[model samples]
Each structure stands twice: as C-alpha cells, then as structure tokens.
Target: MAISASVSLVMTLAFLLASCGGMGTHRGTPLELTIAHINDHHSHLEALPDQIVRIGGVDTQVELGGFTRLASAFRSYEGRDNVLRLHAGDASTGTLYYTLFKGRADADMMNTICFDAMAVGNHEFDDGDAQLKSFIEQLHTGPCKTPVLSANVHPQRGTPLAPQNAEDYIQPYAIKNIRGIPVGIIGITIKRKTQDSSSPLPSTSFEDETSAAQRTIDQLKARGIRHIVLLTHQGYQADKAMATKLSDVDVIIGGDSHTLLGNFSKQRHLPKSAGPYPTRVANRDGKPVCVGQAWEFSKAMGEMNVSFNAEGDVTSCTGQASLIIGDRFKRKDAAGKWVAVDPATPQKIAAEAATDASLKMLAEDAIASNVLRSYSSQTEKMQKESIGEASQALCLVRTPGESFNASGEVAGCEEANQRAHGSDVTQLVAQSFLRTSLRADLALHNAGGVRIPVPAGAITLGQAFALMPFNNVLIELPVTGEQIIAVLEDAVSSYLDAGRSSGGGHPYAAGLRWHLDMSQPKGRRFSRLETKDRQSGTWASLDPARTYIVATHEFLARGQGGYASFKPIYDSGNYVNTHFLYTQAFVDYVRAHGKVQRPAPADYSHQAVTTQAGVVLH
Candidate 1:
C-alpha cells in the first residue's frame, strides 16, 4: 500500500497513542475504527461500460463501478479487525433493474456486501410502504440480517409499515460491538423531502429531522454507548450544519444529493468534487466530527478511518474515496466510433492509473457477478426491444444554463443548455403527458423526474424505463393561470433561493411559456406568461381568472417538490388521476408519433432567463 505523507503522520499518532495505554485516561479506552461505505447506488448493480476516464492525462474509455466491484472491495477487509461496512442509503430506483424487479434485484445485490446497516432513503417509498416492506424482508432473508433504519419516520398503526409492529420493519439505530466497544449508529432520513417528493402513505408521518436525531441520541446515550455515528440520508451541506447543532456525533456517513467529496483534481473525467473527503466539522461540544459521502451510481466508495480518545471525541480522521474501474481501455477512432485499444495498452494504462490514489482497478467479485447475472438476463432482453428512435440526442439539464451534463457524454447536445430552455428530455416527457390527456390544456413536470439524456438512434424499452424510472401515474387538475404562475415561482425559489441547487424542484412544462428572471422576488420571477391554443396551435396571453386543465405526474400533483399550489386544487376534489403509468405514456407517445426530435424553438417553455446576478440567457 502506498501511504501518503498524511497517512504516515496518522499512523505515527496511532502508534504513540497505543503505546501510552489509553493516553492517561483523558481518552478512556481509545478506539480506532475503519469504515468502508458507499451511497446512492440507485439499483445500478451492473458496471457502466464505455465510460471515458482520464488516465495519465489521457482520455481512456473503461468500465467503472457496479455491485460486483464494490463487493470485491468490501471483501478485501474480511479478516481485518475493527472494520465496519456500511451503505448510507438510496439502494433502489433509477434503472431497468428496479423497474422490472422493483428493488428485489437491488436487495440481492446489496446482500452481496451484507452491509451492517442501511439507512432508509426517500425513494424506498416510491412504490408505497408495502413495496418497501417487501424489499426490507428480502434484505433480511440473507445471512447478513442488516438493519434498515430511519429515526424520523412514524408509521400509522394500521399502515403496511406498522401493521404488526414498527420495530419488525425498521429500526431507529443499530449497535455494533467492535473489539468489545459498543458503537451507536443512528439513522436519520430527510424528513420534508421524503414526505413531499416520495409516495409514503398519507396516514404515516415524519418527525422533524433535528429533533428526532437529538431524541434518538439521548436514548442511545442512556444505553451507555459513547461512540456515535450518524448514518444519514440528508444532503452533504445539511449534514455539516447538523453537526454544529448536535453534540456527541463523532462521524457522519451520508447520502442524498449524491455529493462527491474528495480531491478529484487528477481525475479529469469526473466533475469538480463537492469538497475534501472526510470533511471535518465542529460539533455542538466543539469536538471534531468527520463527515463523508460517496458519489452516486456505484461509481465510488468512501473509506474513512477514525481514532477516538477515551472520552469518545474524534482524535484523528483520515481517508479518501476511490473510483472503481477495470483494466479494459478504449479510444475513439478517426471516424468518431469507439474501438478497443491494442491488447498491450490495458497493462500500461493500469500501471499509470495505479499511481493515482483515488482510482482502483479491481476485477468483479465472482459471487456478486453471479447474483447480478440472474436478474440481468431478463433486463437484457427487455433492453433490446426498440420502442422508438431519435434523430438527435436529447440533452438532460435541470437548471437552464447550469453546467451539469455539459460534458461530452451528451455528444452533439453538449451546448444544449447554453440556450434559454432547460431540459429537452423533461420537456418531451411533459409533451407526452399533454398529448395523452385530451382534456388537459397543459402539462408540467419536474426536471429531477427525468433521469438521463437520450442518445440519437434506436430507443429501447429499457431506455424509456431508465429515463422515467419512478413509479408515478399521470394526473390532471383544473388550475387557474394564477396558480400556474405561483407554482412556477415556487419551483424556482425552491432551488434558487432555498438552496436545493441539486435540481429537484425546477419546472419544465409543455403548452406553456414564460420569461424567467431570478433577480426578481417570489411570485415575480415569471413574466409574459402564455398558453398555447390546443385547436389553433397559437400562443395566447394567459388570464389569471381562466381555469385550465394541466397534466402532470401524481408526485407533483400531490404538492411534492415545491408544487404547493397544486395540492389544494387536488384536495378540493378538482383533480382526476388517469392511472396510466408515466413511463408507459411516454412509450405510447413515441408509438403514436413517428420519431423523437428536439422541440421546436417556439415550443420551448423557457423563452428567456435572467440570472440572480442580472445576466440574461437568450
């Protein structure tokens, strides 16, 4: 193992502390722990192939991530003492695997690692509590019996989650005895975001995150557990702030927001990381709290090692996240087609890649590979059946003019967001909803609902499923023009003003157009509001008093993701659910319409945009 200078310093301190026999009792029985963790795998059990990564300052295509490689990494520490394996959260949704098997496949793959404990992410309830229950049951069926936890969730007595007993399904925390010392791992899920954006039963409720975490910490303290680790599904920024608000939380392994926390300066293929790995924050008691999160989609794993004093205060913390990869390499030919490199290049690339601390080259684990093979055989056939074709790739952008997806991954559509319009893929989804609902005059959709960009060529059944993987249904509501403007403002403020820049609340709509100015306050960002005439194909100014039927997914219509105006209209008995699956509606739209193409400029929802800095995007 190549030990960096910092690692050497940490090791020296560990040795001296060990020699001092508990550091003279100010530290108590000093404990040193190793944690291997991953988060937001999101059902991506198979490795992503043909990904371009920079090795030795050269662009080389290779396979990256997957449960197989993650399993291999975890198994490497099998005989090591005081080592803990954990998965932060978000083990389901976002791919064909979840679409077809509904988290069963995810559970099988997750059991490969046999995590000590897994936090309950919001997407676990996408199919409702019953489905979550089934997935949890499968997770426990294996030998691991990993605890599924959420401290803030409160299930109703008769609900599927708590029908018999809440403890039977979910736990508030797990106690892991490492080397004769009991360590408390408390789980905290995002309270508001889960209740708003997911499909939890209305009868079930959630407690505030801070209060729940504090209360749980008190309970765990009463049990005499000194070392505390908060395994949270809260965003990275939120977790850092949470540390300052609480005491005795020595470490946090978090998910949600899919944050990449590491020094990726040498990894050119990856985006700019959020921060340094094992980000250190000060807790309420002024003690150091180590916080870390792995990037999403099974791409990377975070390994953190922490040493505590006898008093359970974090004395030292060190570690880094490694991007998992294989040795196979590819490069684009002169004709712009991807072709495998010469056989000799693989070893050379691997030798050079080994120098970078963040890159790990490991072959897939045999047991995990076999488990994934059983489920992938069915998805392969489903992926092959073509549902539609696209003449040009559709760009996936959440906020207009933001830098995400601007990489070469989208091909010719790299500059798509440089224009005023936001997401081409989400706009197409909204259009599909509008076309399917004859009674609706407009369709609205959240940018986060659409997963990936569409490549030009034959679109398969699996591609459609992957693009719209949530278990959402189409709904229609008669909302006034004023309500439409209010919702748009709400969506914009949710991300811009409220700091959810991770892109869940930004709105994209069909049959509606507006000029957006972020410099304006709430309810004033949208101007020049217009609605298209279904009959004449002409745009007309919207009237605040006129009621228009709008089509959208059930998630948004339920007032989730900043669409608060729609909830009242839905509760007033003025809404109708088409019950048609949103993904199926997209497939039907493709069949009815010949081929997919980028929407015409006039049909775009964002006619213009002005940034908070007063810069305009035309």
Candidate 2:
C-alpha cells in the first residue's frame, strides 16, 4: 500500500480547498507554492544604490529596490502555479514619496505590485486615524484593491473608528486555496503600548496579540483549515514567543522586527520531523513551523516553499529569502516602443543596494512623478527654492562626551542638527505645496525624530526628504511660561539625564539655545533658557507666564520621544502637514538670499553648570 504522488497532491489540495470553502486554488499543476513578500516599505518608491549584503557568508551586490522593478517582478510571478504576493507592514512613512503624496502614491504603487494582503504596521498610524481612514478609502476605491488584515485593533465606544466605506477592505483573517491546498492567513497589528505615542490612532486601541491570534487560530481550526499563515506587524521577539505558545500555527510571515531570516531555522519547542524543514523548531502537532521576513523598504522579497501532507499540515520545505535589485536598461523594440528593460535577476547579494532609482527619477523629473515631484514642480513654478542659509557649516559629528551624557547629549546635539535639516527640508517641500493656503513660519523639527544625517552638498529635494522621512504634521502650540519651563525640564531629564543618545549627543536647537546644569536633579537641569526672535535680534528671557506660539513636529507635541509634559499643551487647531510648507519656506528663503549661510559661532553658546554630582562639564 504505497501512496502515489498524484494521490498525495490531490489529498493535500482537497484539504486546502475545504479549508477555504472552495474559494480558489493555485494556478500551477505541480502542486508547488511560492510566497513572495516584502515588509516595511515605508513608501521608498525609488531604486537605491547597490551595496554588499552578507547573507550566509555569500557576499553579492544588491542594487537596492524600486517600485517599478517590484511591479515588474510581481507581474512575472503571476500566471505561475502557487504564487502569493504580500507585504508585512510599514508601507507608508519614512521616505520623500510618502511625505509628498501623503501615502496616495504609495497605495498606487502597492496596487501596481498587486500585493495580495498586508498587515498594519505601527507607522501606518503616523498620519493619525483620519488620514488612515482616507488611505483606506482610496485603497478600497482603487483598481488594484488588496485586503488589509489586523485582528488586534478595537473601535471606540461611540465614534466610527473604522470607516464604513472601507469595512470590506479590512479583515481579521482570510482563507485561500493555493494549488489545491487550503491555507489560512491571519493578520496582526503591533501593540500601541510598545510604540511611540505619536502614532495617529485616536479613540482606538490594540488588543493582546497572543490572545487575539489564539482566537483566530481556533476559528480557522473549527472551519477545518490546518495550513495556517500569520501576517504579523509585531517584531521578531514577539513572533518567536507567539510561535512557542501557539502550537497550532504552521507558518508565521512576520514584519516590524526587520530581521533578515536568510534561511529557515528550527523553533524552540517544536520537534524534529522525518524530512528537511525550513525551521529548527517543530510545533506540538509535529508540523515544521517556519518564520520569514523581508527587511524594510522593497529592497528584497522573501520566498518560502513549503510541502504538506495528506493532513494539510506542512511537512517539509526548502526556500531562500531572495533580495530583488532594481536595474533599468533602455532598449528599442522592432516597432520602436522604447521599452524599459529590467535587469533584476535572482542573485545572492553580499550587501543591499544603496541607490533607489525610482526616487532619483522622481527627483529628476519633479513633476510627472508622484506627489513629491508635483510639489517640487509647484515650488519651482512659484520660485520658492531657498530657505535661510546656514550661517556656518553644520555637519554631523560624534564627540566622546556623547557616550557619557544621560540623554546622549552629544548624540542628541548631532541628531538635532540632522533633524533641523530634515525638518527644514520636509517643511520646505510641504510649504511649497500649500503656498497659497497657509503662511510659512520658522521651521521646527525634533532631534529625536531625525534618524540619519544630512550629507553636505547641493541638497536635492530627495535628500531633504530622506532626513525628515516621517510625514509628521507641523503644529503651532501656545505654551505659557510655566509650560515652557516644564517642557525644557522634560527634555533635559528625559534626553540629557536619561542616557538615551541618538545619532551623536546633545539636543540641536534651530532658533533657541540654553545652558544646563546636569548635576541638578532630573526636573531642574535647565539653569538658563533663552530664545532670540529672528525679528527682535536680541536674546529675550522665556517668560514662564506668557504663551508663545512654537512650531514643532507633531510627534513631539503628542508627547512622543519622552516629552510627555508637552502633551497637555498640544494645539490640534494649528496642526498642518509640514512636508510642503517647510519645503516652500526653504525655497523662498534660499531664492531670496541667493547663497545661505550657516549660523555663526556666536549664535549658539553652551556651558555646563555645577550641581550636586560635580562641576558638570561637556
């Protein structure tokens, strides 16, 4: 009584079909399935530079990623047997494309890529609930509509947190048939408690992932579906723990952790199987459970091939996580259509690509492209190209003191400079978009939000966009003299005293400067606070009682980056997306002044004050 190959395939397919209520099956005949996935794209709609990414000791050049190339690759996967295209999360934010388009272009790009489904990452809420709803609306109404799933989000008691028009656009779980095999897909969102408060999820909350996943798994089991797949926005550690606890789950397609799982490894509590498996650990059901993820951006696509038995459980699987590099070559057809040839081949790269071509093209054209280009063209048309020049050179450098400061003051200082550029750049572009609608003001950016440094050169619109990638709204909040001191104290205690150094150290100030006494207790670090109104030209004491309209990134006003005290003073009325606003401001400033100058040495002065710890010094 030997099992025939066709019989086994038929049984597996039957089980899979039964699991999904006979909705659909894979396109191929071999009964083989391949899942191609990307995560944390963050709207990096460009082809990046090539770089060496070391994976399994094989060094290769990965030319980086672009949405256009990704679309081509995804289309190639179509008409193939058992191919699934998906994204893990963080599809919006972190790049210029998102900043200029407010996620509309990214959504279009995703539609072109034909993503089957995506989990909701934390950054999806960076624009807040209202914007998120709008994005959902667009996706629902768009031509290339895909399912979005999240089991953890709970609506508020009164308000319609989930949009009515987009209800069908989102689901907690989906069951699909792949090559006659029933596969259950479950989506999970990140817990808001662990994320920064700046996430734009008002009146909504997240549930416990493990509990929510357990319920979904049980529901799928009741439906007779056994081949389970989890599309999760939770990070790697959480995924590992969930796998250990939830034995019924077969495969966990994860994001948010951004770990490069080049090959399948064994699970902790799972057992050894009779054949080769993707993971080291086996589940209680004796099925080989696998976990996979593709790092942020469309830099790479993850592929996993799994083989199941008559029971519809994964038995053995072999696959490699492949990174897709974007390369374009111009060629002519017989009829002379001037087609764009894609040079992306599935090769093992030693490093990821550094350049993003899609972004570069957008920069060069600045109009025909998506939102950023449109904004740039508008700015140029209005002759808004320059902002106030640097009085002196402000370059990001790491000093030794950065290692010792509580807030990583040195790092904070350097990052502040970086963020100033990022914020200024984003603000300039955003301002350009809304030139006719709103009046521009001094661009203010939070040091904590700046993730990278601004390279010195003829700063392109793209360069500024990379620095201030988060599409945070600009907020003009009025804080009394007492609130101002409280905010400064919060910055010192959380940033200076608390040893969390980002970038270099020391918080960078664009239009303000002050001296701090580190030895003083947490709330008493700022010994002197001063601000120079660009108009006044003279340093003025920050009155504790008088309210002043301060421009800041929305993240800071919402008490993100450890500045919880400022939350109370957050003014929702004056909030606007600074992406176009600031860019326009910079363009106007630069055009008016021709060549800008960095601030002079005298513009910024600092001295460490003595405290109980010692004569604090930097």
Q: Best candidate, TM-score-wise?
A: 1
How does model 2 score by TM-score? 0.63
Summarize candidate 2's per-residue lDDT along 1-618 as a digit string, tens digits.
257888999899888876866534432223355777889887777665533333333333334566666666567676786877878888877666677678777776676666777887877777677666667666656565677888777655443445453244457887667765567788898674224534644567677898889898888877766677889988665676678777688787888755556532321111111222134456655556777776566665667787666555666666655455533323345685544434452221111222221111111222224533444454343222223344333343221133212111121233332221222222233232223223322223444354333333344455445545665555566666577667666755554453333321223444445566556787666656666666656777667777665566567667665556667666445444444344334445445555544444434423333433454443
C-alpha TM-score for every candidate = 0.92, 0.63
Name the runs in model 2 displaced over 4 angstroms: 1-33, 49-63, 94-96, 141-144, 156-167, 193-201, 257-289, 309-318, 327-444, 451-453, 469-550, 560-562, 571-618
lDDT of 1 at 374: 97
- What clash pairs does model 1 have? 27-310, 27-311, 28-310
